[model samples]
Target: MLHKGEAINIAPNVVHWHGASHDSRFTHIAINPNVSQGGAVIWGQPVTDDEYNASRS
Candidate 1:
């Protein structure tokens, strides 16, 4: 589980997702540089609570 004041770094072009645990709050800042060089952000399907909880297991 992640604790407060912790952060994760995702490299460019990596397929990943993240969020806060239940009964908690999550906040983040995203930095996308070099967008004009064909960089893009593609969103996938939403993660259900079942999926999130399963990962915690």
Candidate 2:
């Protein structure tokens, strides 16, 4: 887990998902270059409850 002030850089086009603990709050900023040109974000399938729950293990 990331500590305070730590950050992760995800390369463009890489698939990833981020979330916080159920009892805590989390926030982040996303900077997408040239997003005004369209298609800067391409979403994939939804993360299911089972999948999400398992990830916390």
Candidate 3:
């Protein structure tokens, strides 16, 4: 999870995901401005079985 001071830059039209390790708790807040016309959140692909299995502590 992202702590108080940590930040991430998500580019436009890019698909990505982030979360804490399985053994730990994860929490984060997303802030989006509504001024843009295409202001909406979209979810793409789900985590693959292989990807989940490859995650490390």
User: Quick one: best TM-score, which candidate?
Assistant: 1
**Candidate 1 lDDT over residue span 1-57, tens digit each:** 678887787888799877676656678677778679877678789988897677467
Q: Which clashing pairs does model 2 show? A: none
Clashes of each: 0, 0, 0
TM-score pick, better of 2 and 3: 2
lDDT of 2 by residue, 1-57 (tens): 878888888987788887665455678777787688873888778867876677467
TM-score of 1: 0.61
Residues forming the 10-long window of minimal summed lDDT in candidate 3: 19-28
Candidate 3 lDDT over 12-39, as tens digits, reads: 6777877665566667667777538785
Ordered by lDDT, highest first, the candidates read 1, 2, 3
lDDT of 1 at 16: 82
Per-residue error for 19 in candidate 2, Å, reads 0.8
lDDT of each candidate versus the true structure? 0.76, 0.75, 0.70
- Tell me the lDDT of candidate 3: 0.70
